[model samples]
Target: MMGGLSIQKQRRLIVFAFITVPLLLLLTFAYYPALELIRLSFTDWNGISAEKNFIGWANFKEVFSNPEIFGVFKNNVAYFVVGIVQNIAAIYFAVVLNGKLRGKNLFRLLLFLPYILNGVAVAYLFGYVYDTTNGSLNYMLGQLGFDKLSETSWLGNTSIVNYSLASIGFWRFMGFNMVIYLAALQSIPNDLYEAASIDGANGWQKFIYITLPNIYKIIELNLFLTVTGALEVFDLPFVLTRGGPAGASETFVLKIVETAFQFNNYGLASAMSVVLLLFVIIILSVQRYLLRGKGE
Candidate 1:
């Protein structure tokens, strides 16, 4: 009995090591970098040769007080709002495609192709589309008796740059969101719809009662992903507009990049990042609460 117990103990130790090793690696690589970023947020240090001082909240205050930062925050909000609409549009499109139709597979593949394209490539392509004078958009405008609009600077104008950037994001992400909604729609049991029809439900009634309720979780997931993606949006706007003519489309990520790498203010960037994290946490919490309330 003693020998058997010793062997079992050794097996348990081996199992524990196997489980813990990967966790340790994940913590070392992922969690440590996040923690370090948070730590840097509280200090005054440049990423350059290490000679650092401590300053609590000063950088955050500066970030918050700046009009440019606030404008960027507004742009982030617009991005999320626009992204939500884009996802909704995708869901609608997915629903249409989910039904039996000729050429459906080909259509889906065509729509999804853009999402698989390199993001930088998409950004540069739109850059040409939004080009002030010699672009395709301008040529179309000239044909539409709107030649004046053709010369308008899409990226340079503060009032419209965020909208332009959001449009690019919508185009880039719509196909991916459609695929997600399509998967969710396919997962739903069709019997529910058949049952609803048997009970004298019409198309609208069936959709409202059967389709919407069944896909609540998927909608929640998509909402969370869209919000996070929009909030952290950087690459598209970065490549297309480069935050543009007057920082019109700048986002928190851009601000952080400018602070850390451009200005060599690593500590300030860190503080800004911490604030951004807190802001994201707050938004996510509110979303959870609202979703929970709705479900109840």
Candidate 2:
């Protein structure tokens, strides 16, 4: 069909066709559903209902006024704070593993193993680990002579339940961040470090001046991802605690699920989902702007 066309025009046509098909599919599948979700947020529709009543802003008003909603966001904030600690731990592991150490590849593989497991499997595994009676953690504590802590309810107590859940996120994802940072670390030029060493710069000084500056972009990217993951966390908390004992571990996404599936409040759930999406967009936009400004 393109026999009469110039070679350049044929290549351009091929490229356009390749791009247009995926772009069209993306708009059809992804963006269309997203637009529908926004539309649903403005109406009162039980998921089963054929008729949806247009109730402008009512769902939003209810979501904002609910006391439980505030607690859900509070849990999200707690998760985000814990994620910062997780990022720091990942950086430490990455820095150490990037060195000329024996068995580093094996160690990296082991650390990253948990992240590749199914979320449901990880949840069940950790559930057993955190179980109050006859759990591995309690048994270990007993063996270590901390018998008092052996009987402590790790997932049942409100005071520590959020922390317990957050720890799972740390364990599962820290290796992912470590691998990213490790890649960044390996890409740093050895000449920079060599030059620093000749100038009598110590390990800490070299890290501060040469290593940190070179990998700052990757660091920012990891931090942004951590924040977003923390905000959207649902699976582990849902499978392990069901956002309980008494909603102690309730996250925003879990709340959205419960609202839509359990209570049949599709409109309210949609509203909450839109709000969460907007919150993430605004946060990421601010982060991108700040990073770009710093780069400039």
* lDDT to native, each model: 0.83, 0.89
Question: Tens digits of per-residue lDDT for model 2 on 130-182?
Answer: 99997999999999999899999999998888888888888888898899989
**How many clashing pairs per prediction, in order?**
2, 0
lDDT of 1 by residue, 1-296 (tens): 34656888988988999999999999999899899988888788888767777787787788789776655777787788788899889988888899888999998888788888898898899889888878888889989989689788888898988888888878878888889889988988988878887889997787787778877887888888888887788887788777876777888898888878998989888888878788778978998888894522
Q: Name every residue pair that clashes in candidate 2.
A: none
Please give the lDDT score for candidate 2: 0.89
Residue ranges of candidate 1 with Cα displaced over 4 Å = 1-14, 293-296
Cα deviation at 130, candidate 2, in Å, is 0.7
TM-score of 2: 0.95
For model 1, give the 10-residue run with minimal summed lDDT: 1-10
Q: What are the models' TM-scores?
A: 0.91, 0.95
